[model samples]
Target: MGLFGNFVAGGLAGLAVDLCLFPLDTIKTRLQSEQGFFKAGGFSGIYKGIGSVLSGSIPSAAIFFIVYEGFKAYYSIYPPGSTSEAAVQAIASALGAIAACIVRVPVEVVKQRSQVSLDSTKSSLDVFRETVAKEGYHGLYRGFRITVIRDSLFSLLEFPIWEQMKTFYAVYYGLEKTAPLAGACLGGVAGAISGFLTTPIDVAKTQMMLADSDALATKMGLLQSLVRIGGQGGLPGLFRGAVPRVCWISIGGFIFLGVYDSALTYMSTVAV
Candidate 1:
Protein backbone atom coordinates (compact mmCIF):
# COMPACT_ATOMS: atom_id res chain seq x y z
CA MET A 1 0.00 0.00 0.00
CA GLY A 2 0.95 3.66 -0.46
CA LEU A 3 1.79 6.24 2.18
CA PHE A 4 -1.73 7.65 2.17
CA GLY A 5 -3.08 4.15 2.61
CA ASN A 6 -0.75 3.64 5.54
CA PHE A 7 -1.80 6.93 7.05
CA VAL A 8 -5.50 6.17 6.89
CA ALA A 9 -5.12 2.59 8.04
CA GLY A 10 -2.88 3.52 10.94
CA GLY A 11 -5.07 6.38 12.09
CA LEU A 12 -8.16 4.22 12.11
CA ALA A 13 -6.35 1.37 13.80
CA GLY A 14 -4.90 3.59 16.48
CA LEU A 15 -8.23 5.22 17.18
CA ALA A 16 -9.99 1.89 17.47
CA VAL A 17 -7.40 0.33 19.73
CA ASP A 18 -6.92 3.36 21.94
CA LEU A 19 -10.59 3.92 22.53
CA CYS A 20 -11.17 0.24 23.18
CA LEU A 21 -8.41 0.01 25.75
CA PHE A 22 -8.44 3.48 27.27
CA PRO A 23 -9.54 2.25 30.65
CA LEU A 24 -6.58 -0.07 30.88
CA ASP A 25 -4.29 2.77 29.89
CA THR A 26 -5.76 4.95 32.63
CA ILE A 27 -5.23 2.21 35.16
CA LYS A 28 -1.66 1.76 34.00
CA THR A 29 -0.97 5.48 34.20
CA ARG A 30 -2.38 5.69 37.69
CA LEU A 31 -0.37 2.69 38.76
CA GLN A 32 2.77 4.44 37.52
CA SER A 33 1.84 7.80 39.05
CA GLU A 34 3.89 9.20 41.91
CA GLN A 35 0.77 9.51 44.03
CA GLY A 36 0.12 5.77 43.85
CA PHE A 37 -2.88 4.14 42.23
CA PHE A 38 -5.36 4.64 45.06
CA LYS A 39 -4.54 8.27 45.45
CA ALA A 40 -4.69 8.70 41.68
CA GLY A 41 -8.44 8.02 41.66
CA GLY A 42 -8.22 4.23 41.87
CA PHE A 43 -10.96 2.76 39.69
CA SER A 44 -12.90 5.90 39.29
CA GLY A 45 -12.99 7.96 36.07
CA ILE A 46 -10.75 5.81 33.93
CA TYR A 47 -11.94 7.76 30.94
CA LYS A 48 -10.79 11.09 32.30
CA GLY A 49 -8.18 12.01 29.76
CA ILE A 50 -9.69 10.21 26.77
CA GLY A 51 -10.45 13.46 25.05
CA SER A 52 -6.80 14.39 24.84
CA VAL A 53 -5.82 10.94 23.67
CA LEU A 54 -8.63 10.89 21.15
CA SER A 55 -7.49 14.17 19.69
CA GLY A 56 -3.88 13.09 19.29
CA SER A 57 -4.06 9.36 18.51
CA ILE A 58 -5.09 9.64 14.89
CA PRO A 59 -2.59 12.26 13.82
CA SER A 60 0.31 10.67 15.69
CA ALA A 61 -0.45 7.19 14.42
CA ALA A 62 -0.97 8.44 10.91
CA ILE A 63 2.36 10.23 10.97
CA PHE A 64 4.10 7.12 12.32
CA PHE A 65 2.80 4.74 9.64
CA ILE A 66 3.47 7.24 6.89
CA VAL A 67 7.07 7.68 7.98
CA TYR A 68 7.54 4.00 8.73
CA GLU A 69 6.18 2.78 5.39
CA GLY A 70 7.95 5.53 3.50
CA PHE A 71 11.26 4.64 5.12
CA LYS A 72 10.77 0.91 4.47
CA ALA A 73 10.08 1.64 0.81
CA TYR A 74 13.12 3.88 0.56
CA TYR A 75 15.32 1.33 2.32
CA SER A 76 14.09 -1.40 -0.04
CA ILE A 77 15.21 0.67 -3.02
CA TYR A 78 18.48 1.93 -1.56
CA PRO A 79 19.21 -1.40 0.17
CA PRO A 80 21.40 -0.45 3.12
CA GLY A 81 24.47 -2.61 2.51
CA SER A 82 25.01 -5.52 4.89
CA THR A 83 22.41 -4.35 7.41
CA SER A 84 20.20 -7.15 8.61
CA GLU A 85 16.45 -6.98 7.96
CA ALA A 86 15.89 -6.82 11.70
CA ALA A 87 18.20 -3.83 11.97
CA VAL A 88 16.48 -2.11 9.07
CA GLN A 89 13.06 -2.69 10.64
CA ALA A 90 14.36 -1.37 13.94
CA ILE A 91 15.68 1.78 12.29
CA ALA A 92 12.39 2.39 10.52
CA SER A 93 10.39 1.75 13.67
CA ALA A 94 12.54 4.11 15.74
CA LEU A 95 12.25 6.87 13.18
CA GLY A 96 8.50 6.38 13.04
CA ALA A 97 8.27 6.48 16.84
CA ILE A 98 10.39 9.63 16.97
CA ALA A 99 8.14 11.30 14.45
CA ALA A 100 5.01 10.15 16.27
CA CYS A 101 6.29 11.52 19.56
CA ILE A 102 5.99 15.05 18.19
CA VAL A 103 2.23 14.69 18.76
CA ARG A 104 2.26 11.85 21.28
CA VAL A 105 4.22 13.59 24.02
CA PRO A 106 1.87 16.48 24.64
CA VAL A 107 -1.12 14.19 24.43
CA GLU A 108 0.44 11.82 26.94
CA VAL A 109 1.32 14.62 29.36
CA VAL A 110 -2.24 15.86 29.43
CA LYS A 111 -3.78 12.38 29.33
CA GLN A 112 -1.68 11.07 32.20
CA ARG A 113 -2.43 14.01 34.43
CA SER A 114 -6.08 13.65 33.64
CA GLN A 115 -5.98 9.96 34.34
CA VAL A 116 -4.55 10.68 37.77
CA SER A 117 -6.58 13.75 38.47
CA LEU A 118 -7.91 14.05 41.98
CA ASP A 119 -11.21 15.43 40.80
CA SER A 120 -13.42 13.25 38.68
CA THR A 121 -15.18 16.31 37.35
CA LYS A 122 -12.03 17.81 35.91
CA SER A 123 -12.04 17.85 32.13
CA SER A 124 -9.09 17.27 29.85
CA LEU A 125 -9.40 20.89 28.76
CA ASP A 126 -8.93 21.86 32.37
CA VAL A 127 -5.75 19.86 32.55
CA PHE A 128 -4.48 21.42 29.33
CA ARG A 129 -5.27 24.93 30.49
CA GLU A 130 -3.79 24.35 33.93
CA THR A 131 -0.61 22.90 32.51
CA VAL A 132 -0.11 25.77 30.10
CA ALA A 133 -0.99 28.35 32.68
CA LYS A 134 1.26 26.89 35.33
CA GLU A 135 4.21 25.76 33.23
CA GLY A 136 3.66 27.36 29.84
CA TYR A 137 3.22 25.51 26.58
CA HIS A 138 6.26 23.42 27.36
CA GLY A 139 4.39 21.71 30.17
CA LEU A 140 2.36 19.82 27.62
CA TYR A 141 5.60 18.37 26.32
CA ARG A 142 7.38 17.93 29.65
CA GLY A 143 8.40 14.37 28.90
CA PHE A 144 8.99 14.79 25.18
CA ARG A 145 12.57 13.58 25.18
CA ILE A 146 11.95 10.67 27.47
CA THR A 147 8.80 9.77 25.56
CA VAL A 148 10.69 9.66 22.28
CA ILE A 149 13.38 7.52 23.83
CA ARG A 150 10.90 5.13 25.41
CA ASP A 151 8.79 4.77 22.26
CA SER A 152 11.81 4.39 20.02
CA LEU A 153 13.12 1.66 22.26
CA PHE A 154 9.72 0.03 22.31
CA SER A 155 9.37 0.17 18.53
CA LEU A 156 12.86 -1.16 18.01
CA LEU A 157 11.89 -4.29 19.84
CA GLU A 158 8.25 -4.56 18.80
CA PHE A 159 8.28 -3.91 15.07
CA PRO A 160 11.22 -6.14 14.28
CA ILE A 161 9.88 -9.03 16.32
CA TRP A 162 6.41 -8.66 14.87
CA GLU A 163 7.79 -8.56 11.35
CA GLN A 164 10.11 -11.47 11.94
CA MET A 165 7.33 -13.58 13.38
CA LYS A 166 5.12 -12.85 10.38
CA THR A 167 7.98 -13.72 8.06
CA PHE A 168 8.46 -17.01 9.84
CA TYR A 169 4.80 -17.80 9.59
CA ALA A 170 4.66 -16.91 5.93
CA VAL A 171 7.74 -18.95 5.11
CA TYR A 172 6.52 -21.95 7.04
CA TYR A 173 3.05 -21.91 5.52
CA GLY A 174 4.22 -20.84 2.07
CA LEU A 175 1.64 -18.10 2.16
CA GLU A 176 1.96 -15.06 -0.04
CA LYS A 177 0.23 -12.84 2.52
CA THR A 178 -0.15 -12.90 6.27
CA ALA A 179 -3.63 -13.11 7.69
CA PRO A 180 -4.87 -10.43 10.10
CA LEU A 181 -5.31 -13.02 12.81
CA ALA A 182 -1.71 -14.08 12.54
CA GLY A 183 -0.57 -10.47 12.57
CA ALA A 184 -2.71 -9.81 15.65
CA CYS A 185 -1.29 -12.73 17.56
CA LEU A 186 2.29 -11.87 16.67
CA GLY A 187 1.78 -8.18 17.39
CA GLY A 188 0.31 -8.96 20.79
CA VAL A 189 3.26 -11.12 21.78
CA ALA A 190 5.77 -8.58 20.52
CA GLY A 191 3.99 -5.71 22.26
CA ALA A 192 3.82 -7.61 25.54
CA ILE A 193 7.53 -8.35 25.41
CA SER A 194 8.47 -4.81 24.52
CA GLY A 195 6.10 -3.30 27.06
CA PHE A 196 7.39 -5.47 29.88
CA LEU A 197 11.02 -4.76 29.04
CA THR A 198 10.48 -1.01 28.78
CA THR A 199 8.48 -0.60 32.00
CA PRO A 200 11.31 1.14 33.84
CA ILE A 201 11.74 3.74 31.15
CA ASP A 202 7.97 4.19 31.06
CA VAL A 203 7.86 4.65 34.83
CA ALA A 204 10.49 7.34 34.68
CA LYS A 205 8.74 9.02 31.77
CA THR A 206 5.45 9.03 33.69
CA GLN A 207 7.03 10.55 36.76
CA MET A 208 8.76 13.17 34.68
CA MET A 209 5.55 14.22 33.01
CA LEU A 210 3.48 14.16 36.20
CA ALA A 211 6.01 16.05 38.30
CA ASP A 212 5.10 19.46 39.48
CA SER A 213 6.88 22.49 38.09
CA ASP A 214 9.29 22.70 41.01
CA ALA A 215 9.22 19.01 41.85
CA LEU A 216 12.49 17.12 42.09
CA ALA A 217 11.40 14.74 39.39
CA THR A 218 10.77 17.68 37.10
CA LYS A 219 14.27 19.03 37.69
CA MET A 220 16.00 15.68 37.52
CA GLY A 221 16.96 14.00 34.27
CA LEU A 222 15.60 10.60 33.15
CA LEU A 223 18.55 8.72 34.59
CA GLN A 224 18.19 10.52 37.89
CA SER A 225 14.49 9.77 38.07
CA LEU A 226 15.13 6.12 37.32
CA VAL A 227 17.84 5.93 40.00
CA ARG A 228 15.55 7.61 42.49
CA ILE A 229 12.72 5.21 41.73
CA GLY A 230 15.02 2.26 42.09
CA GLY A 231 16.44 3.65 45.31
CA GLN A 232 13.02 4.16 46.91
CA GLY A 233 11.01 1.22 45.61
CA GLY A 234 13.66 -1.19 44.34
CA LEU A 235 13.07 -3.37 41.27
CA PRO A 236 9.36 -3.74 41.84
CA GLY A 237 8.93 0.01 41.86
CA LEU A 238 10.60 0.30 38.52
CA PHE A 239 8.16 -2.19 37.08
CA ARG A 240 5.11 -0.70 38.69
CA GLY A 241 2.06 -0.84 36.42
CA ALA A 242 3.91 -3.23 34.16
CA VAL A 243 1.11 -5.77 34.24
CA PRO A 244 -1.53 -3.31 33.18
CA ARG A 245 0.74 -1.76 30.61
CA VAL A 246 1.57 -5.11 29.11
CA CYS A 247 -2.04 -6.13 29.07
CA TRP A 248 -3.13 -2.84 27.55
CA ILE A 249 -0.49 -2.81 24.86
CA SER A 250 -0.84 -6.48 24.11
CA ILE A 251 -4.53 -6.09 23.43
CA GLY A 252 -3.98 -2.78 21.73
CA GLY A 253 -1.26 -4.11 19.50
CA PHE A 254 -3.42 -7.02 18.47
CA ILE A 255 -6.22 -4.73 17.46
CA PHE A 256 -4.03 -2.01 16.00
CA LEU A 257 -1.92 -4.24 13.79
CA GLY A 258 -4.84 -6.45 12.83
CA VAL A 259 -6.88 -3.48 11.77
CA TYR A 260 -3.96 -1.89 9.96
CA ASP A 261 -3.26 -5.02 7.94
CA SER A 262 -6.93 -5.57 7.17
CA ALA A 263 -7.44 -1.97 6.16
CA LEU A 264 -4.34 -1.86 4.05
CA THR A 265 -5.31 -5.07 2.29
CA TYR A 266 -8.71 -3.72 1.51
CA MET A 267 -7.29 -0.44 0.30
CA SER A 268 -4.77 -2.16 -1.92
CA THR A 269 -7.49 -4.27 -3.52
CA VAL A 270 -9.71 -1.22 -3.92
CA ALA A 271 -6.93 0.69 -5.64
CA VAL A 272 -6.45 -2.19 -8.04
Candidate 2:
Protein backbone atom coordinates (compact mmCIF):
# COMPACT_ATOMS: atom_id res chain seq x y z
CA MET A 1 0.00 0.00 0.00
CA GLY A 2 1.05 3.60 -0.57
CA LEU A 3 1.61 6.01 2.31
CA PHE A 4 -1.94 7.26 2.08
CA GLY A 5 -3.18 3.73 1.69
CA ASN A 6 -1.22 2.53 4.72
CA PHE A 7 -2.67 5.41 6.66
CA VAL A 8 -6.14 4.37 5.62
CA ALA A 9 -5.37 0.74 6.29
CA GLY A 10 -4.01 1.27 9.78
CA GLY A 11 -6.87 3.51 10.82
CA LEU A 12 -9.69 1.38 9.40
CA ALA A 13 -8.13 -1.64 11.01
CA GLY A 14 -7.91 0.06 14.39
CA LEU A 15 -11.47 1.35 14.18
CA ALA A 16 -12.79 -2.03 13.10
CA VAL A 17 -11.15 -3.73 16.05
CA ASP A 18 -12.23 -1.03 18.47
CA LEU A 19 -15.88 -1.22 17.46
CA CYS A 20 -16.05 -5.00 17.48
CA LEU A 21 -15.00 -5.22 21.12
CA PHE A 22 -15.78 -1.85 22.70
CA PRO A 23 -18.16 -3.61 25.10
CA LEU A 24 -15.14 -5.23 26.68
CA ASP A 25 -13.78 -1.72 27.36
CA THR A 26 -16.96 -0.67 29.12
CA ILE A 27 -16.67 -3.86 31.12
CA LYS A 28 -12.99 -3.29 31.81
CA THR A 29 -13.43 0.27 33.10
CA ARG A 30 -16.32 -0.64 35.39
CA LEU A 31 -14.33 -3.63 36.58
CA GLN A 32 -11.35 -1.42 37.34
CA SER A 33 -13.43 1.33 38.94
CA GLU A 34 -15.21 -0.81 41.53
CA GLN A 35 -14.79 -0.15 45.28
CA GLY A 36 -12.49 -1.95 47.74
CA PHE A 37 -9.15 -3.44 46.87
CA PHE A 38 -9.36 -5.58 43.72
CA LYS A 39 -13.00 -4.64 43.41
CA ALA A 40 -14.43 -5.66 40.01
CA GLY A 41 -17.87 -6.53 38.82
CA GLY A 42 -18.62 -10.15 38.00
CA PHE A 43 -18.96 -11.43 34.43
CA SER A 44 -22.62 -10.47 34.08
CA GLY A 45 -22.36 -6.98 35.48
CA ILE A 46 -19.46 -6.06 33.23
CA TYR A 47 -21.30 -7.35 30.22
CA LYS A 48 -24.35 -5.28 31.02
CA GLY A 49 -25.48 -2.68 28.44
CA ILE A 50 -23.76 -4.37 25.52
CA GLY A 51 -26.56 -3.29 23.25
CA SER A 52 -26.19 0.36 24.17
CA VAL A 53 -22.42 0.18 23.84
CA LEU A 54 -22.74 -1.03 20.26
CA SER A 55 -25.26 1.66 19.54
CA GLY A 56 -22.50 4.21 20.07
CA SER A 57 -19.10 2.49 19.69
CA ILE A 58 -19.17 1.14 16.13
CA PRO A 59 -19.51 4.50 14.45
CA SER A 60 -17.21 6.09 16.96
CA ALA A 61 -14.51 3.63 15.89
CA ALA A 62 -15.05 4.54 12.26
CA ILE A 63 -14.60 8.23 13.01
CA PHE A 64 -11.52 7.57 15.13
CA PHE A 65 -9.83 5.45 12.45
CA ILE A 66 -10.56 7.82 9.63
CA VAL A 67 -9.26 10.74 11.63
CA TYR A 68 -6.18 8.76 12.54
CA GLU A 69 -5.57 7.89 8.91
CA GLY A 70 -5.91 11.51 7.94
CA PHE A 71 -3.42 12.52 10.60
CA LYS A 72 -1.00 9.86 9.33
CA ALA A 73 -1.25 11.32 5.88
CA TYR A 74 -0.72 14.81 7.21
CA TYR A 75 2.36 13.78 9.18
CA SER A 76 3.92 11.59 6.52
CA ILE A 77 7.64 12.15 6.24
CA TYR A 78 8.38 9.38 3.78
CA PRO A 79 7.37 8.52 0.27
CA PRO A 80 4.60 6.14 -0.61
CA GLY A 81 5.31 2.39 -0.40
CA SER A 82 8.41 2.95 1.72
CA THR A 83 8.96 0.96 4.91
CA SER A 84 11.45 3.41 6.41
CA GLU A 85 8.55 5.55 7.55
CA ALA A 86 7.34 3.13 10.17
CA ALA A 87 8.11 5.69 12.84
CA VAL A 88 5.82 8.17 11.16
CA GLN A 89 3.09 5.57 11.10
CA ALA A 90 3.55 5.05 14.81
CA ILE A 91 3.24 8.78 15.45
CA ALA A 92 0.15 8.87 13.32
CA SER A 93 -1.37 6.05 15.35
CA ALA A 94 -0.67 8.01 18.51
CA LEU A 95 -2.33 11.08 17.10
CA GLY A 96 -5.26 9.00 16.00
CA ALA A 97 -5.63 7.43 19.43
CA ILE A 98 -5.64 10.85 21.01
CA ALA A 99 -8.38 11.97 18.68
CA ALA A 100 -10.34 8.79 19.28
CA CYS A 101 -10.16 9.08 23.05
CA ILE A 102 -11.24 12.72 23.02
CA VAL A 103 -14.23 11.82 20.91
CA ARG A 104 -15.12 8.74 22.94
CA VAL A 105 -14.91 10.04 26.54
CA PRO A 106 -18.56 11.03 26.80
CA VAL A 107 -19.51 7.69 25.32
CA GLU A 108 -17.20 6.01 27.76
CA VAL A 109 -18.91 7.77 30.65
CA VAL A 110 -22.35 6.80 29.41
CA LYS A 111 -21.48 3.23 28.55
CA GLN A 112 -19.74 2.68 31.87
CA ARG A 113 -22.54 4.19 33.93
CA SER A 114 -25.05 2.18 31.93
CA GLN A 115 -23.13 -1.03 32.45
CA VAL A 116 -22.49 -0.66 36.19
CA SER A 117 -25.71 1.07 37.21
CA LEU A 118 -27.73 -2.00 38.00
CA ASP A 119 -30.29 -0.69 40.44
CA SER A 120 -32.75 -3.21 38.92
CA THR A 121 -35.13 -0.52 37.68
CA LYS A 122 -33.16 2.42 36.30
CA SER A 123 -33.20 2.49 32.50
CA SER A 124 -30.29 3.84 30.39
CA LEU A 125 -32.02 7.20 29.97
CA ASP A 126 -32.66 7.37 33.69
CA VAL A 127 -29.03 6.71 34.45
CA PHE A 128 -27.91 9.26 31.87
CA ARG A 129 -30.31 11.88 33.19
CA GLU A 130 -29.31 11.27 36.76
CA THR A 131 -25.68 11.56 35.78
CA VAL A 132 -26.34 14.86 34.01
CA ALA A 133 -28.65 16.35 36.61
CA LYS A 134 -26.49 15.41 39.55
CA GLU A 135 -23.13 15.87 37.91
CA GLY A 136 -24.09 18.66 35.48
CA TYR A 137 -23.42 18.71 31.70
CA HIS A 138 -19.67 18.71 32.19
CA GLY A 139 -20.13 15.76 34.53
CA LEU A 140 -20.84 13.46 31.62
CA TYR A 141 -17.36 14.30 30.46
CA ARG A 142 -15.68 13.76 33.82
CA GLY A 143 -12.54 11.97 32.75
CA PHE A 144 -12.34 13.58 29.35
CA ARG A 145 -8.80 14.88 29.55
CA ILE A 146 -7.39 11.93 31.48
CA THR A 147 -9.03 9.49 29.11
CA VAL A 148 -7.53 11.29 26.13
CA ILE A 149 -4.09 11.06 27.64
CA ARG A 150 -4.44 7.40 28.62
CA ASP A 151 -5.96 6.31 25.33
CA SER A 152 -3.43 8.29 23.32
CA LEU A 153 -0.45 7.01 25.26
CA PHE A 154 -1.65 3.43 25.22
CA SER A 155 -2.27 3.49 21.49
CA LEU A 156 0.94 5.39 20.74
CA LEU A 157 3.03 2.82 22.55
CA GLU A 158 1.05 -0.36 22.06
CA PHE A 159 -0.14 -0.20 18.44
CA PRO A 160 3.20 0.69 16.89
CA ILE A 161 5.05 -1.78 19.09
CA TRP A 162 2.54 -4.44 18.18
CA GLU A 163 3.03 -3.70 14.50
CA GLN A 164 6.79 -4.08 14.78
CA MET A 165 6.36 -7.21 16.88
CA LYS A 166 3.95 -8.70 14.41
CA THR A 167 6.39 -8.09 11.60
CA PHE A 168 9.17 -9.73 13.56
CA TYR A 169 6.98 -12.70 14.38
CA ALA A 170 5.85 -13.05 10.79
CA VAL A 171 9.46 -13.00 9.63
CA TYR A 172 10.62 -15.40 12.38
CA TYR A 173 7.74 -17.90 12.50
CA GLY A 174 6.21 -17.52 9.07
CA LEU A 175 2.56 -16.56 8.55
CA GLU A 176 0.92 -19.85 9.56
CA LYS A 177 2.55 -20.10 12.99
CA THR A 178 2.02 -16.39 13.73
CA ALA A 179 -1.67 -16.98 14.17
CA PRO A 180 -4.31 -15.93 16.68
CA LEU A 181 -2.33 -16.94 19.74
CA ALA A 182 0.66 -14.86 18.68
CA GLY A 183 -1.51 -11.82 18.19
CA ALA A 184 -3.15 -12.46 21.54
CA CYS A 185 0.23 -12.69 23.25
CA LEU A 186 1.33 -9.44 21.67
CA GLY A 187 -1.91 -7.84 22.81
CA GLY A 188 -1.59 -9.16 26.36
CA VAL A 189 1.94 -7.93 26.61
CA ALA A 190 0.95 -4.59 25.13
CA GLY A 191 -2.02 -4.30 27.45
CA ALA A 192 0.01 -5.14 30.51
CA ILE A 193 2.68 -2.71 29.43
CA SER A 194 0.31 0.18 28.79
CA GLY A 195 -2.01 -0.70 31.67
CA PHE A 196 0.87 -1.01 34.08
CA LEU A 197 2.53 2.15 32.89
CA THR A 198 -0.67 4.16 33.17
CA THR A 199 -2.14 2.58 36.32
CA PRO A 200 -1.32 5.61 38.44
CA ILE A 201 -3.34 7.88 36.19
CA ASP A 202 -6.01 5.26 35.79
CA VAL A 203 -6.46 5.01 39.54
CA ALA A 204 -6.58 8.79 39.83
CA LYS A 205 -9.19 9.07 37.11
CA THR A 206 -11.32 6.47 38.85
CA GLN A 207 -10.98 8.09 42.21
CA MET A 208 -12.03 11.43 40.78
CA MET A 209 -15.21 10.10 39.22
CA LEU A 210 -15.96 7.76 42.11
CA ALA A 211 -15.28 10.15 44.95
CA ASP A 212 -17.04 13.02 43.21
CA SER A 213 -20.27 11.79 44.74
CA ASP A 214 -18.90 11.49 48.25
CA ALA A 215 -19.20 14.53 50.50
CA LEU A 216 -16.33 13.69 52.74
CA ALA A 217 -14.47 16.13 54.95
CA THR A 218 -11.30 14.98 53.27
CA LYS A 219 -11.19 15.74 49.58
CA MET A 220 -7.96 14.74 47.90
CA GLY A 221 -6.46 15.80 44.62
CA LEU A 222 -5.13 13.42 41.94
CA LEU A 223 -1.59 13.38 43.24
CA GLN A 224 -2.88 12.87 46.77
CA SER A 225 -4.80 9.81 45.59
CA LEU A 226 -1.65 8.38 44.12
CA VAL A 227 0.20 9.09 47.31
CA ARG A 228 -2.67 7.69 49.35
CA ILE A 229 -2.69 4.53 47.27
CA GLY A 230 1.04 4.25 47.69
CA GLY A 231 0.84 4.88 51.42
CA GLN A 232 -1.93 2.33 51.85
CA GLY A 233 -1.20 -0.50 49.40
CA GLY A 234 2.17 0.41 47.92
CA LEU A 235 2.90 -0.56 44.30
CA PRO A 236 0.50 -3.50 44.14
CA GLY A 237 -2.38 -1.25 45.14
CA LEU A 238 -2.04 0.86 42.02
CA PHE A 239 -2.45 -2.14 39.82
CA ARG A 240 -5.49 -3.47 41.59
CA GLY A 241 -7.18 -4.68 38.42
CA ALA A 242 -3.98 -5.66 36.66
CA VAL A 243 -4.86 -9.31 36.58
CA PRO A 244 -8.21 -8.85 34.84
CA ARG A 245 -6.69 -6.17 32.60
CA VAL A 246 -4.05 -8.56 31.33
CA CYS A 247 -6.59 -11.27 30.62
CA TRP A 248 -9.07 -8.91 28.99
CA ILE A 249 -6.37 -7.19 26.98
CA SER A 250 -4.89 -10.47 25.79
CA ILE A 251 -8.23 -11.61 24.48
CA GLY A 252 -9.07 -8.18 23.10
CA GLY A 253 -5.66 -7.73 21.52
CA PHE A 254 -5.80 -11.01 19.70
CA ILE A 255 -9.37 -10.50 18.55
CA PHE A 256 -8.68 -6.90 17.55
CA LEU A 257 -5.54 -7.57 15.51
CA GLY A 258 -6.78 -10.80 14.02
CA VAL A 259 -10.05 -9.25 13.00
CA TYR A 260 -8.42 -6.06 11.73
CA ASP A 261 -5.79 -7.80 9.61
CA SER A 262 -8.37 -10.02 7.98
CA ALA A 263 -10.92 -7.24 7.60
CA LEU A 264 -8.43 -4.74 6.18
CA THR A 265 -7.26 -7.16 3.54
CA TYR A 266 -10.88 -7.64 2.59
CA MET A 267 -11.59 -3.90 2.77
CA SER A 268 -8.66 -3.10 0.51
CA THR A 269 -10.13 -5.23 -2.18
CA VAL A 270 -13.69 -4.05 -1.55
CA ALA A 271 -12.73 -0.37 -1.41
CA VAL A 272 -11.26 -0.81 -4.87
Q: Tens digits of per-residue lDDT for model 2 on 100-187?
A: 6654666666666665564646555676688789878777677666677677777777766776676678778656435555765776
Residue 181 error, candidate 2, Å: 8.3
Q: Which stretches of candidate 2 lie over 4 Å from their true place?
A: 1-31, 37-44, 75-86, 170-188, 213-222
Error of 2 at 161 (Å): 0.4
Provide backbone clash counts, one per model: 0, 0
Task: Mark the 10 consecutive residues where model 1 has the least summed lDDT.
Answer: 77-86
lDDT of 1 by residue, 212-255 (tens): 88889988778998999999999999999999999999999999
**Highest-TM-score candidate:** 1
Model 2 worst lDDT window (10 residues): 209-218
TM-score of each: 0.97, 0.75
Which predicted model would earn the best lDDT?
A: 1
Q: Which portions of model 1 miss their true places by more than 4 Å?
A: 77-83
